[model samples]
Target chain A: MQRLLYSLSGASGQHYSPHVWKIMMSLKHKGLDFELKPVSFGDISKIEDGSFTSVPVLNDQGTLLGDSFEIAEYLEETYQDAPSLFDGPGGLQLSHFVESYCKTVLHPTLAVIAVMDMYNIMSDADRAYFRPAREKRFGKSLEDVYAGRDAELSTLPEKLNPVRDLLTNQDWFGGEKAMHADYVLFGTLQWCKVCCPDPILAPSDPVNLWFERMLDLHDYMGRKAVSEAVAA
Target chain B: MQRLLYSLSGASGQHYSPHVWKIMMSLKHKGLDFELKPVSFGDISKIEDGSFTSVPVLNDQGTLLGDSFEIAEYLEETYQDAPSLFDGPGGLQLSHFVESYCKTVLHPTLAVIAVMDMYNIMSDADRAYFRPAREKRFGKSLEDVYAGRDAELSTLPEKLNPVRDLLTNQDWFGGEKAMHADYVLFGTLQWCKVCCPDPILAPSDPVNLWFERMLDLHDYMGRKAVSEAVAA
Candidate 1:
């Protein structure tokens, strides 16, 4: 059986979609061998039967799955013999909490901070689709939104205090080992690292330290990702 | 062996301390029989030895434990045969994240919103102690801090988006059942309900729905708490 993960990619092969990275780490966590098929944002909907609307549409030997959380659940339930993605009880709830934190708290902040940088790195077709879509969502031009980038970036660390505080007492968000919760956060942080040159987290910050450890996970899967700097 | 939980109470027996409520729900979750001993703010230090300076100092058999997190760990370890508090693997880390969320995000906002109400409900001695201590911490008079109550209250529901989003898909933060994470948040919401007449969460919000379920937990332990309106 062949496994394939369709991921959102940049012009220079940068995998910057946080949702895609989550599945990437999750597949590796379950010890599944898979191929990464990169798709531009404009091409995401055409990945399979044109029914899908996003990246991270996983095809597990013809069994198609969409949505990162749903795919994770599928992986956990199907590959029960492998290491668990949720680890124990409350894992699903905790993972969802982390996801919400990223979606509500962190993503908005990052979108403002990385708007221009993200646009510059995207394929022309994706850039054409991205600007008008995001501008409509923000009710402003991309340039206007990116104008407040520094102020928006300043709030990122404080927003991450809960994660930092959790790390202060435990090695991983999954308690002793990295689980879906850790991957959820790691994917978000990795998105920022890949798209933007400015460090979202300070070097001395505990979150950065955890990110370093996360980068070293699954045979340095994250470390091997092509960042904007490396791509440049 | 006798079990007792020392909780901070107001002049009219209003048990409003969030930390104390966490242990209360936790004890009930573990099905442990215990007494809730109410203490004024000034009476905390003398609860056991003069070394302790907080509520939620749990006396299990002869061993005393301070700090709600520590007491939870102790409970999970001591009552290994009972219903677990930290349900599965990442329970500890997730519980801590919930605690940090309440402490960092919710508590400051609540402190500002409930400053006057909390002060008014306290005993004379506690009022005197709390006013000066909290004022000094905020670098302003309690009255001045309370002036910003409306603004502080407005920011609370937004801060709770992560929790609200989590509750959108799951019945409890502890997944299928209420665990330490659910208790952690329940304690914070219960503190607001006990300390003020104002509703922190809108009655129709999903979070409020979850809070209702939480109140119904442990044989109506939370529902039985004396709220400010009831006390009045």
Candidate 2:
């Protein structure tokens, strides 16, 4: 019986999905070992009887899980003796607020900022499926979406102000230790780190510094991940 | 030991300061009874020898405290057996993230949206001080600052998406019960509820519903407050 994680991979095999990176770091945080199987855009629906539509689908020795938040909860409940991801109920619920921040504030901005770069790094089959879908969703051509990204890019720091403000007084989102809240935000930034050619944050920014520290966590799993931008 | 909370009040003696409201709710949440003392803008500098510059100053029998977060930590540490504001360190730290959200996203937008309303509710003396100070800060006259508020008002909903998204699945920021994070946001929205003439949230919005629940907490403390908007 083996644990397996189906992840979204870039053309060059960089595990680039933000949601997948969340569970990837969370699994490592819980001291769980799993084989990472890369899946392309077109391959997601075919992962398990066409039931799942996203990556970070965990096959934990026959128990299949889909959403990243659900997978995090499963890992926490299943590995009770391991280091707790959420310290208690307060941490657990507030972690959702962090997730909300990532979704509403970070994801949408990063999506526009890195759309073309994200498209450029996708497999041909993935690109074929991605372009029309995203173009329709964004209501613009991929190139057109990429054109106004400088304006979008300029807004990233302001979009990240909350995290920057939090980091001004604390080393991590989880206070003295890193927790799921930290991972939720790290996952968002990690997406841009792996995809965007233009730098998303300043080197001296507190959030950027926190990201640097996050990359070194879990024995450098994030640092060692097959980053497409790094490979370039 | 007498516990006294110096709160900022409007002309009609409404406790309108967002930071003060946080401590007000947190005090009640911990079941610690304190006398509420109203302070005008001019009186803040004269409070306890002019050292402290803000309201929500907690004078717990001569152990005067300033800063809402500091006061919260003091309560959490001083009263270990009471119902915890933060369930643990994780919750404590994440509450700061909530604070950051209130400061960057909610406060700025609400400040613009309710600038004139806030001025109108203040005493004539406060209006004089507030007008020049705000004009200097905004680089515009009070009327002009408020003239452009409709555009600012339109941005509030999207700005509040993070909180709205969080409340969809959970009863409160603390999951089963309210915590400091809930108070943190409650204080923010309650500021608008007391001062803003136009409704800041839709009647059916999840955030508005959560706020309604919040007002009813602590035996209708929020509902019982001398609301200037209610008086108007």
Best DockQ goes to which candidate? 2
Predicted candidate 1 versus true structure: per-residue lDDT over B19-88, tens digit per residue: 8889999898888989878888778888877779888899888899999999999999988999988776
In the order shown, the candidates' DockQ scores are: 0.68, 0.78
What lDDT score goes with residue B190 in model 2? 86
> Runs in model 1 with CA error above 4 Å?
A227-229, B227-229
lDDT of 1 by residue, A100-134 (tens): 88898998888888889889889899899999999
Q: Backbone clashes per model, in order?
A: 0, 0
TM-score of chain B of each: 0.96, 0.96
**Model 2: residues >4 Å from true position, as ranges?**
A48-50, A226-229, B226-229
For the candidates in turn, chain A alone yields TM-scores of 0.96, 0.97
List model 2 lDDT by residue over B42-114, tens digit each.
9998887578888889999889899999999999999999999999888898999999989988888888887
- Pairs that collide in candidate 1 are none
* A1-232 per-residue lDDT for model 2 (tens digits): 8999999988888778999999999999999999999999878888865799898899998999999999999999999999989887778889999999899888888999889988888889999999999999999899999999999989988988899889999998888989999999998888878887667889999999999999999988888873434774
For model 1, what is the error of residue A220's alpha carbon versus the real structure, in angstroms, after optimal superposition? 1.8
TM-score of 1: 0.95
